[model samples]
Target: MYDTILVATDGSDSANRAVEQALDLASMFDAELYGISVVDTRRYGDSMLSGSSGVIDDLSDRAEEVLAGLEAQADVGVTTTVRRGRPHEEIERYADTVDADLIVLGNRGLGASGEIGSTAERVVRYIDRPVLTA
Candidate 1:
């Protein structure tokens, strides 16, 4: 049984799977789903950074939008969070803050498929909480 649940997402397909899985678990256990999306602001100054005025804000907004959609689809108790920073750091911090019984996240991110993302692996190593990957 679980109460509070947190999922780190990036609006990717795998993240969507995590949302669906989290939703199913929440419904089964009557748990509350807390969705989180972190915008890695560090990308702004990186060489790959594209020219943009509101890159950070845009990512935050997009993240919120994606989470909102998931919440709407779940149609149960759901909460959304958007932050700018390293994905693993923000997710770990959120897990601690929420004291989540379970932290559900996609093993793979928006990057390559069939392999777990580095951020997800980092979160698993750094955070002491439970993580269920979809």
Candidate 2:
């Protein structure tokens, strides 16, 4: 029932599980799989160390590494991306751009300290597509 499946990863354990689930679903439906990791630029406000300190670059690199790992593990071809912005917004925009049929996300990610990550919660609330939290 799914044509394009998108999974948001943060390199956290739960995110890894979500990736696995997305991979399986994509395989089952013979659908294309896309992975995205977003660097939350909001965290680094307008502080003196925001853009000039290489913090964003480091975060972007880490995000790329996460997507690379996801691509490596998938048996089916996977398209991966890294974005900079609010996690939920970036994820939603990317999903819409890809015309994804399903979105998979971890219940909690690296920055989450509760039962559900804020980004996942926001995406679930605002995005129109079906979302599965692993």
Candidate 3:
């Protein structure tokens, strides 16, 4: 029985499916649902590259918007958070901070590669808790 469930989303179709699965799992287990959207800032670094002005800000804004939309769709009471960093690392860190019993994430994301996205692969590699890809 999970006490807390975390879902990492990027507003992609796969991620949305994961969200629904997480919500359903949370509802079934009567667990607290937590949502996170991470703005991948590893490429941006500390200083803005000349051509990438407002790119970080834009990503951050999109992350918040994604979280907001997820919150609206959630049937159970959900706590949503936004973080800036590599998606996999930030997600694991956040899950650890919240003591999540399970992590629900997408098999693929916006990138839509034939294989799983690096974020999901890395998260599975590093996280100690159960991860369900929907």
Candidate 4:
């Protein structure tokens, strides 16, 4: 039973499976679907080196492109959000802020029994909301 479902995606194949599953659930319950893709802004290898680079725009643009694809596949009531921040924290905070009934995410090849996968694993450890991993 869910009203507002939040689907956290990383633009990955695994996350896409989660998206498809969430869409099916949303359709079944006639629930509103909310999709989000988070872009981690924290500097990485090159960023840490302070080398000549301008990848933030690249990342944001790429996210928007992916989000656009997601928006196209989402249900009629589904809305899309593109955020820039820590993946796990952003997903958890957004889910809480929206008062989401369910937080659905894909297991990034890291789930085994009680042990969760990468992104989902982190979100589970911090979020108080109910998480549905696919």
> Highest TM-score, which number?
2
**lDDT of every model, 2 decimals:** 0.84, 0.91, 0.90, 0.78
Candidate 3 ranges with C-alpha deviation above 4 Å: 44-53
| Per-residue alpha-carbon lDDT of candidate 2 for residues 18-106, written as tens digits (9 for 90 to 100) | 99999999999999999999988887786754548588888889999999999889999999999988999999999999999999999
TM-scores, all candidates, are 0.90, 0.95, 0.92, 0.83
| Clash counts for the predictions, in order | 0, 0, 0, 0
- Candidate 1 lDDT tens digits, 20-101: 8899889888988888999887755665455564766677789989988887888687888898778899998888888899
Better of 1 and 3 by lDDT: 3
- Pick out the ten consecutive residues of candidate 4 with the lowest summed lDDT: 109-118
Cα lDDT of candidate 2 equals 0.91
Query: What is the C-alpha lDDT profile of model 3 across 7-121, one tens digit per residue?
Result: 9999999899999999899989999999999987766665664457578778889989998988888889999998988898899999999999999999998977788888889
102 Cα displacement, candidate 4 (Å)? 0.7
| lDDT at 99, model 1 | 85
Model 3 lDDT on a 0 to 1 scale: 0.90
User: What TM-score does prediction 4 earn?
Assistant: 0.83
After superposition, candidate 2 runs with Cα above 4 Å error = 48-53
What value of lDDT does candidate 4 attain over all alpha carbons? 0.78
